[model samples]
Target chain A: MTPDDPKDPAGQHETVPGTSPGASPQGGVVPDSRGEFTPVRTDTPVADPGLPAHQWRPTDVDPKLEKRAERQVAGMFVAAQVFVVLFVVSYFVFDIGGDGDAILGLGASTVTLGLCLGIALLLIGVGIIQWARKLMGDHEISEMRHPARSSDEDRTATLEALRVGTEESGIARRPLIRNTLLGSVGLLGVPAVVLLRDLGPTPGEVATEQPYEGAGLANTVWADGMRVVRDVIGTPIRAADLEIGDLVNATAAALYETNEEGELVLEGTERLIANSKAPVIVVRMEPDEIEDVDGRENWTVDGIIAYSKICTHVGCPISLYERTTHHVLCPCHQSTFDLADGANVVFGPAARALPQLALAVDDEGYLVAQSDFDEPVGPSFWERG
Target chain B: MRLLNRTAGRLSRHRRRPVAGLLVLLLGLFATGTFYAAFAPAQAETTASDAAQVEEGRELFLIGCAFCHGTNGEGVLTESGTQYGPALAGVGAAAVDFQVGTGRMPLVQPGQQAPRKPVIYSQDEIDALGAFVASLGPGPAVPEESEYSVEGLSAEEQEEAVVRGGEIFRTNCTACHNFDGAGGAMPRGGYAPSLKGVEPKYIYEALLTGPQSMPTFSNGNLTPEDKADVIAYLQESEEQPTYGGFGLGSMGPVAEGLFAWVVGIGGLVGFAIWIAAHSTRSLKQKGTTE
Candidate 1:
């Protein structure tokens, strides 16, 4: 504490008559902790340089230049106004249909109105920016900063108030109420968990009516002796019809089967449920090209092999077949499978080789599935195990 | 004339008995046959130009393609067992037209694929080459213009054709050619060529032949009408000006997402730089730097 004044308890400054704490920036004698004069060597290598001299913008120096800048900013604002009016005019001038050529594909009114509004907004923004950059203030002002921390007394008072509030609330003392509140808050999540169940039936239940050997993701509608029909046409494919390099997209003939009155065997939702599972790509390559696997030797008929089109990585259909190489690639991800081999995964994200369908020919020489796919088709699930 | 006169002199020298005369006639026929063999090709070139197209094509093929494709269009193989050129037999005139007409053949150099280039052969010469290859085996014939053209369909009919074609193309072509026919990558270091601006005739022939790594969609799999419908769909989609600016190769999300990351973020960084440049600190630094 300075001996000169009792109010200055912390001794922030020397008892020097005229100089304040920061008034003397360089070497100056002041009272230290011992109350003795101490010469402080506070010399800086570089002089403390303050804010640079503000350069005058052309608008600031010359009235003529300032007027021109004002005019330019005004011009942009006027252009924005004109576009706003044009936007309204175009909305009336062009129709959504009929003469749809406002701007290739997008309806005339839609493109024009959108373009005009977008431009108007952009112009107004640009005009405001230009006005600020040129016509408005170019001076760079520094905002003085002070310590953000509160005073020691104020900090102590706040902490004391918080402690009192907490003590009165009795949150720590009331364990029974706290535990029950936590329990109720946690149980609130039950409704949300139950709501998600109705999103759809289990992926397998759709085909429950028919007691097919495989259930849900495990099986498709393909059965023994089922003809593999061409995709969109639903016509049965003859093995002879496929050329050496031909990759035919086929579905099970059961999807197209008719009953006594000729109603489709699987209609609407049943067909939709079964359709994705049933698609198989039948590719014909030379017999010598195929890499033989045990038990799969009879699966191919005359160098023709059938594989599930769905990718093993995700369920994207795999049909990009290269004839000479006998590779089929999935477009979703570049998962390449060698169809000539046992549909082995040759490249990319697919973990397993595509499921192979045992293929045979019917009495009429039409290609047919000997049995269902050997395993499940799509991506792996928790229940797959 | 001298050859004819010599043959006649040889005929006269033979004996003139019943059995001997028959033998003499055979000798004369042999001489005439030798004379014709020596001069007929030249005469065929000079007199019957229309019939000599295949012959002319053979000569051109020998000069341009024989090194890799052999003298008889029988393919050659490398020591590695990879094809230098596959045999042109049973590949048809349509295959020849697609390969050569599109300038994918007479390969610049052997590689994984034959990329499209400027057509070197004239239309007439291409026809002759096609004819020559067709003569090698009974392959598909070149399609008539009417078969591939969709100009005959009414607007409504074309719309219906497009819908049908879209389904067929999605089922068959979308795996490689992509949903928009912008094309996608294939196995190995191969690519499915973009179908944009491709002629309907070449599209037809390509579907028939399969070309390079592409699988053939045989006539049995997709009928001629179905093939035409695919062409119709492609043409219709191409004619409808792209809805969004810059299709980004129509590679779907991959390219569009890449563009967003590059350009969208790039624009923000550029604005940041401008703001930094105009800041009070940088402006002061700029004054001192000068």
Candidate 2:
């Protein structure tokens, strides 16, 4: 550290007890004026424990034993080779998948290939380890560690060399060039930071700008009258079909948009985005059991109540329902919501209740969303206000 | 004997009627009734056997289950109102079949959960128990084997069902049952049991019954076809070997990651210690003072 640099915590040895002033090799560890080496520590907190006496291995003293060990290690290496051959042979001999019978629930080929290759590698590793342990030149060698810091003379010489180079280059005298070079080098990192913007659009940008109306963080494509369909199969849920204690993972039918050719119009990323926000789990309980949320009296058709599947805690899709208790648990963190009581958080870390999607039945008797969620779904953010 | 008595009583009542008329009517009725009853003894035997089975089931229940379940399967409650055994009134054939078939009922002792134990009841006894419960009220009936099997589906359709079932399983079953149906933890001390090697009929009944903490995937929620698909997938999946590595308990990444980190890293750490501290032969210590 430069003595003139105020920011640097220079002369730290003066404050720290373990590292006294002269103990620092950076200032060059020198002898006191008495012409004798000054002890680095006169009062040792603990005495240095010397190395214990080493024991001799049987293979080290006995020639016959050493020969036997050498043969044993060689045998392992030979066995490794045999397994390697077996692996190669098994490749051609065994039928994969459905053709041959399974062994212990594993395919014939998988079992043989895996066992052979695995044993070969295991043998090689063990052989090398045994050879190292038993037959190699084994001695307890103490390596004296050198001081980590460079010599004071070397440090001074390096500083001097750097000073001379910089002076010759006129960098210190030419502040204009030096500052601009620093500025340009620092600016070079900006592109890397700026490139991260392409990870996705800003959260609400899709809602404000995307062609699909209200499809983003603040809104979903689940508009009024959109049929609630099964998550993967995309079959619309008929209200009559759902019985008491039944839980169905569902989403808006808008997610299954198609073109004339029967290809999904909402393909890839667009569908994923819309579907993520609109995941709904429709569950039916006895109508008498429901404790209606204020102003949401008509939200349920019969006993069928639909709510967003996304957890209020961190947005993991939750549908581990216990129909008897009317409790739904989130697997990620045990946040439980009482579906009978307006989807309120009865336990765990969820700060807000699960957002409910009001539902209606269409003329075709399919369950449909009355509207998008009144409150924003999922984990809270700073800008949620 | 009862039928003969009823016929004799009817004859006495019609004693004042014309003799020919009474004789002709009695002959026609007796011949048709007797012939049908003899040939179709099957129909009459079913009703008789059902009543007999229910009676036998009731006797078994009184001996084994009544201590907790009460005399008529009308649940017994501990003083605090916590259910000792929930009422079996509407639980029906499916619930009784799943609980008894899995050997979860007739609990050795009460606990937070009923783990799968050695099934004490024979198949006939279990069916009798199921029939007894079914007589109590209308609820889900025990599923037939055809409902939960791939017997009717074509090979191509079976493959399609497996794919569909995988998706459904991930959405519905994976949270508690785990990704590979190896089972995982529940809210308190309860756990979802592994679906591995479980009979297809039991799986179907379990879905219908909502055994323990498992939610009901009723025929309505997961249609009969969906249930069949799930069973087909589970059966097929159990037969297939793990490709990547050890199943590692199949609790998804948590167990697998813990295993790798603890075993792999811990092994390396122990190896490092071994390398540092061990040597086969002794040092001479000639000029090793430094």
Candidate 3:
């Protein structure tokens, strides 16, 4: 039976333009070509889906409004250029690892660079959204559903439609916007490469750059006759000052050093990095309380001993002292060191003993280093041995 | 010639009889005894002054401290048979001076720890008490005020003291008191009180006495200069201005994280909502006017 037959019910329903995709109650009453009533089956409920009438955007209809929106979008791209330039300037101008240049507890380099880059990205995103909402062509489109399997002729027609849509987008015609967007996005890559410089100072450079010879990862600022000063205030320690059971954090006296005019000589990053590695804890116990370590008999001066503050496990400054037991704990990972027995690892994951500093009294009565720590301090690394 | 002849005669006599040699040795011993007797009074005089102070301190101890510490200051037990107070006989002068000087003892009520309060006893009474406590047994003696003071030190020495003080404070006190000396929690109910407004003299006493759970930083341990350095660090910390903005108690990362989220992110979120609302209103108004 032919579907175009005047009595066919299914062919009649397909002709309705605005009707919802469902069967009408009166559908089955229509007679078929064979003069019998046929049932029309549909899973969808019947309802009239009335779509709202399209309203024109002001920028779509008014030439002046459209011109304003185009300029506004271009302005955002211009603002993005400013932010990108700021990001580059911030990279060079701000001290990345210096004291007194922190904002919100972060380095000024970190805060300014992040803000500039973030704003640059946000501007590009906002500009694109504005361009789409106000300047781009506005129209409503609807397409009827086709069968899953397409004929050879329909596939050719779909490709032709895509070509037409691309032309209507007008991207190539708007050279000003297209060029500015490309420029801002391309500039973002420069900051990415610039930020990579923060990875760290090159290997072997730090030691060579130091003013004091042999002062670096391999050697601390301590040397023969340099007084062991208190870490912050820079006061020299005396052997007679500390009593048994007292633990004091100390550093190389070079940190507190001043020029002839009395101005601080180590004022910034150089001082910070050097002091962190050179920190040590001085503990005093009775001469009898200490166990004799082979070859280290004279390391202690009147029951006072010095050990590197850096934990061997992960290089955290270890200072939680149990005076009675002569144990010091690292808060970072619970690594415990027995100070009396040459600072041997007693618990947790540390594998080696903390480095000990040989001590002597200077001519002026303050505690001074007999020499630098015998071994490299801090966490064990491949080149450490 | 006559002296030489006499010496030869005595030597010949000693050789003939060993009793003559014994008589010479006993005479030498008697001469040494006379020399010791002349010097003994000078040493005893210094102790006599200390003994007078101890005698007066004993009377004050009976009236003020003997109730909980025992009549002999030997410590006592409670009704339940538990040791209510520890024996203070051998704690020395430093312990008594620190406990009473800081006003932690003569405690109104007993708790896990004694808090610092206004001292009830006069300064002389406190010193007398210290002397009596010292006489009971040998222990760490009280340190003089000048021992932990930077007043007479040179500019360089004073600077060194402050720097060393910071180092010592970081190593010893930061565990319980925090980096800023704002105090922090202990394992149980105890806490390290803030050192912000504490007197320097009191700080020295606190180290010497090791009030509560704090271990005594004795002359043998921290040393007088070490204690002075610690005091300098504390004073420096108080004088320092908050570098950036509000320190938020200098609680470190946790407080900073909270401020960033609430103020920074919340401001951005509020700005976004305002933009969204304004955009919708303008769009609706334009459509209606058209």
Candidate 4:
């Protein structure tokens, strides 16, 4: 089957015998022994009925103009090399944050390194294009048709085309474009190598800055005295307000803030993170019904106690309350906890009990935290073991 | 010799008095025997009627419960003295009916406490055996049907009863069972059985029976209709469609997010990748061929 046949799977286009695929069928166009030639057609229709005779560019006619174009292309390549060098220098000179020099709100190292690397790549690209267009082969060649598969002759022809293209590009004759094109591409490697320095120091500095001391994956904003409040509304709960069997979804007070107008403030990602971490399930039982944990006698005001709504398994919030049993169930994975028994894991895949938030009645009678959780809340961690 | 013979003759005459004394002692012994026979302890001599009831109850207890509880109601003690079947000595008739009438007594095997099973014993038999056991020691009594019925409650009283019932539900029920009465798992293989679809009578019986892991709620603990009110709430909650989209097991947001993430996002990512690969191949094939 012919390569260009509609049903052909491979991309090769067929060539007619006696003439190349690009040869004109008219006399004087190259033809083979059969005296027949295949005409090549451009995709565009003969608009303007074929334009006025093509005007030769200056470089096509004047050798000096071509030489100057080659030189200009080479200059771009040399400049690219300079920027690559600058990229390496900036890597060493800039103090990422140790010295704290900021450029346009970014660290000096980041801006300088990025700028130099970008310029270096851009110059390399421009230099190559200039060499190809201004000095590369302008003359076209035609060959006789052959089979689609690359025969020995076709392989030799391809190699010849590549050599012809390089000569036509004038890389050998025009030292300026040739050297700059080579230099620019070679320099491109410098930016790539210099950028490696940015990756640095294998392990990162321990995140020991503000709000993150010794606190890794297991820690959150929860601490002693953090009041349990409604998630978005931030309203503090009074034990008296909740009747028996009521399940209130709540979060830590720190999740909410007040605007200047005294309006509640919870916005963006901050609100989302706080809501996820501090979810609490509040339930009211008979005072007698609560199985008081040792030393947590006053944890509940009246019969209301709050426990981390986050499941001790994979952290699904639990609100399925079986009041008669004083059990709160994590619906995900069916982890059941006895709220009365310190939210101890009574069932399911949960490895530990839901952490109970020790609660107390403030002077104003609102429920407040007596203390942070005695242990970490949510799923157990490897470090914790 | 003549004086000794006369004294021996007088002593022989006095022998008549000794024989009369022997006859009086025999009469006293007969009278004591009759008195003792007349007033023997009432409990020891089971009357024909009491005997008949005890015999009937014993038959029923053996047929229905003796396999695990033991033939004599002493409970089958293991070598370690750990009794698998609790001794029924002080567990009164109420306990028996609550257990057996609720179908919780004759457990096939220990599981998450057997739920109230259908009673295999007749009411009269349950009571009779209850009495027999109660005779052993004072224990919790089974409540009559009358005790379970709420007395002449006004609208306000009913409302208050329900409100208190809600309180009880939150405190005791909400832990293992959901606030909505959906059942939850318990420690080990046990579970807090769902309150949903449970009949009010069944709820009352369950509380009374302490079926399975559930602790019994005697009259001293939760009144009968108090159980009824909680049952009522559970039934009512079931009838109402949970507001705001699907309840997603009524487990709240985290599960919803997980469903969305694992199931929803996973499906989306899979679909996206399929579409990407499909479109890339199809579009490129179309471009190259056509």
lDDT of 3 by residue, A198-240 (tens): 6776566543345564456777777898899866657788788
TM-score of chain A of each: 0.72, 0.76, 0.48, 0.44
DockQ values of all predictions: 0.23, 0.26, 0.10, 0.01
Candidate 3 ranges beyond 4 A from true positions: A1-212, A221-241, A252-276, A287-298, A313-325, A329-336, A341-352, A359-371, B1-94, B103-128, B137-176, B185-191, B208-244, B258-290
For each of the candidates, what fraction of the native contacts does it recover?
Answer: 0.45, 0.42, 0.15, 0.02
The residue-level lDDT of candidate 2 at A363 comes to: 99
Query: How accurately is candidate 3 docked according to DockQ?
Result: 0.10
Residues A295-376, candidate 2: write the lDDT tens digits.
Answer: 9999999999988899989999898887667888998889999999999999999998989999999999999988888887
The runs of at least 3 residues in candidate 1 whose Cα sits more than 4 Å from the true structure, single-residue gaps closed, are A1-50, A53-75, A97-111, A135-215, A254-273, B1-61, B122-128, B145-158, B187-189, B243-290
lDDT of candidate 2 over B1-290, digit per residue (tens): 99999999998888767886878899999999999988799878998999999988888888888898888889999999888887888888899888998899879888778999999999899888878888877889888787888888789999999999999888778877888899877766777789998999899998887876666777767888998888889999988756534677777789878987999899978977886576545343423332
- Give residue A281's lDDT in candidate 4 (0 to 100): 76
Point out where model 2 deviates above 4 Å: A1-200, A203-209, B1-79, B118-132, B241-290
Instruction: Give TM-scores for every candidate, taking all chains together and pairing residue i with residue i.
Output: 0.73, 0.73, 0.50, 0.38
The candidate, 1 or 3, that scores higher on TM-score is: 1
Where is the poorest 10-residue window by lDDT in model 2 chain A? A7-16
lDDT, residue B155, candidate 2: 92
Instruction: Select the stronger candidate by DockQ from 1 and 4.
Output: 1
| C-alpha RMSD in Å of predicted model 3 compared with the true structure | 17.4
Clashing residue pairs in candidate 2, if any? none
